[model samples]
Target: LLQGGDLSCVIRERQNSNKLFSEVQVLEWFIQLLLGVRYLHKRLVLHRDLKASNIFLKDGTLKIVVIVPGDFGVSRILLGALDFASTFTGTPHYMSPEVFTCSGYNSKSDIWSLGCVLYEICALDLAFDARSWVKLLMKIVHGPSPSLPESFSEELNHILHRMLNKDPMVRPSAAEILKLPYVAENVKVRSLFILTSL
Candidate 1:
């Protein structure tokens, strides 16, 4: 039998009653996750199942852990400069518009999912929910873009808006996202501190 540890346990422990992460906590999560995603995309990998349950926390830090074989079942590697992946992939709640409509998708698809995850981190709720996958897809494709809590900084709201844009081409790449003022500053400082400690 398969034996393993998973992030769900940690998430449950940290988010008792689904408590929201504070701004500082969310920023820390964002910078570290952005670094991880940037590494993946630079190598042409698409982490199709990037949800809270798929992530593990250790020493107050998080890692994108592939819990099982089928856990990353939908992930793909780009064979060219761009890919038009036509199959519907990823969980319905975090799936992008193109994936829902089967129009085709690329790495930017992950950007949409990241936006949803970012919203969840600060709000402690899924960005969109419904009774069934079909209804959920309908909401994802047709529903207005979800909003972050009013307490979130405007910088985060603007970044999430671009990430969740309906048009995949319009969404920022992982590298571009890391270069954003908010992410760059925080991640840079964190990396420097780590370097000094080494």
Candidate 2:
């Protein structure tokens, strides 16, 4: 069992204490999340509801040991490479614009949700929020894309932007994202660290 609670709880606690997570910590979690999502995608699984509440941390010695994406209740398995899931499901703030159009969405939709999760990790708040569902839909479908704070690195800013692109086809695949220099270095270091720890 995971002793540490979900990411939402961690973000809430940090917000309550007026302490934001450091860039390194956030990147560590982000890379791990990408790895987890990439693994799922490799098996043709789409985690429809990718949100902070669904990501759990395994902690040891008061530090985040592992980041695990849970809650597969709304997930779907694509039968083939060309298949897509057309159902409208997932948290509004994390849903992809294409999902809103009811046209159908694939792995790239999950990339969009990953972008939302990354934004929340950095901003400690929802990337797209509204008082009503209609307003939220409008904002997501037409409003300008949200951005990371000025303090974040340009590489991260670029990644977030690409992941949240209005066109799903433009978004990078999970493997492509992992290949980025910024993300690749982190993944390499993290892998070594895990290896040494074992």
Candidate 3:
């Protein structure tokens, strides 16, 4: 299992990165975003907390999102390729309600949250910031998903729409999403890039 250097080295270099949104290829960016998560699920792990901030690049040049162990202080537990989770946990704004209130959850919920993160990354705001977590969760469960802005790329908007599916079972798997056209494009793409998670 010989490769390059360690990931920490990459992390160190990434510290010098301006920001993920600046001068990054959309394909690589999308891959890193989803690959980071896919790597975890493949290891029979769930990120529990998948967000824009937590998902970071290593070398800032490889453009590959490598999943280490865990973040948010979550130690990655390699449980094999199983998809059952208990003792639910995750961030409120981006979490599947089941992660907090209910018992049944799995890697797919993380995918849903990833979808939310992608939506936020593209639109530059939290898609579900009603007033509080409770309000937001209710809205997510009862209200319609946030509509993609006309200003945003259609491909990205399509990907985001599929990710925000309320039913976890219906949400596209990260692997499936990585194959989308919006993700494969090698163009200079940019949106509002605003930060409101508000």
Q: CA RMSD for every model? A: 3.9, 4.0, 9.6
Task: List lDDT for all candidates, in order.
Answer: 0.78, 0.84, 0.60
Q: Count the backbone clashes (under 3 Å) in each candidate.
A: 0, 0, 0
- lDDT per residue as tens, model 3, 1-198: 013443333333444552333223434456666766777677676667676556544444223233445334542464555546676556677777566557577777888777776666544566788777677778767677786556556666676777777677777877777666656443223222223332
Instruction: Compare the candidates by lDDT and give the number of the best one.
Output: 2
Can you write out model 1's per-residue Cα lDDT over 1-198, one digit (the tens) per residue? 012334445445546755556777788877777878888788777877787777667677778854333554777777875766777667778889888888888788888888888887777778889998788888888888878888888999889889888888899988998899887888888889899999
RMSD of 2: 4.0
Model 3 weakest lDDT span, ten residues long: 187-196
Model 3 regions lying over 4 Å from their true place: 1-27, 57-72, 75-82, 100-103, 181-198
Ranking the candidates on TM-score from highest down gives 2, 1, 3
Which prediction has more favorable lDDT, 1 or 2? 2
TM, every model: 0.86, 0.90, 0.68
Q: Which candidate is the best by TM-score?
A: 2
> Which ten-residue region of model 2 has the weakest summed lDDT?
60-69
Residue-level lDDT tens digits of model 2 in 1-198 = 225888888888887877667778878888878878888889888888888888877762122222223533678888987899999988899999999989899999999998998999898899899999999989888988788888888899999999999899999988999999998998899889989999
